[model samples]
Target: MCEANAYLIEGDDKNLIMEAVDTIEPDGDNLLICNIFGEQKVVKASIHSLSLVDHKIYLKG
Candidate 1:
């Protein structure tokens, strides 16, 4: 319930990367995201902003 969905901003569009994201770790220049379902993704992007109220995680590549 405390998890958030992750998105990658691409110009005028926002792409959903992962849902129910439970953990995020800094992996060098990239980011490592892990969902509650144990799904993992390594994205070459940076943290753009976080909307806690909206339950959203925004990343900029």
Candidate 2:
């Protein structure tokens, strides 16, 4: 199974915005993420550095 999570660092706080996710992308000031339930989430990108691994976005501090 392919399980994933979205983690972001904002200022001095690190947060886990979601779990069991699928994909993520950079959209303007936010990161667009697709959850395991096929739901779309738009979160602020100011918190962390977004990295693309094997075409998947991994948000890191």
Against the true structure, what is every candidate's RMSD? 0.6, 4.5
lDDT of candidate 1 over 1-61, digit per residue (tens): 9999999999999999999999999899999999999999999999899998899999999
Q: Tell me how many residue pairs clash in candidate 2.
A: 2
Q: Write the per-residue lDDT of candidate 2 for residues 1-61, one digit (tens) a residue.
A: 4756666756676567777777767789777888878888887663344433422234653
Q: Clashing pairs in model 1?
A: none
Quote each prediction's TM-score.
0.95, 0.59
As a whole number from 0 to 100, the lDDT of residue 35 in candidate 1 is 97
Task: Report clash pairs, candidate 2.
Answer: 9-47, 10-47
Estimate every model's Cα lDDT from 0 to 1: 0.96, 0.64
Measured on C-alpha atoms, candidate 2 has an lDDT of 0.64
Error of 1 at 28 (Å): 1.0
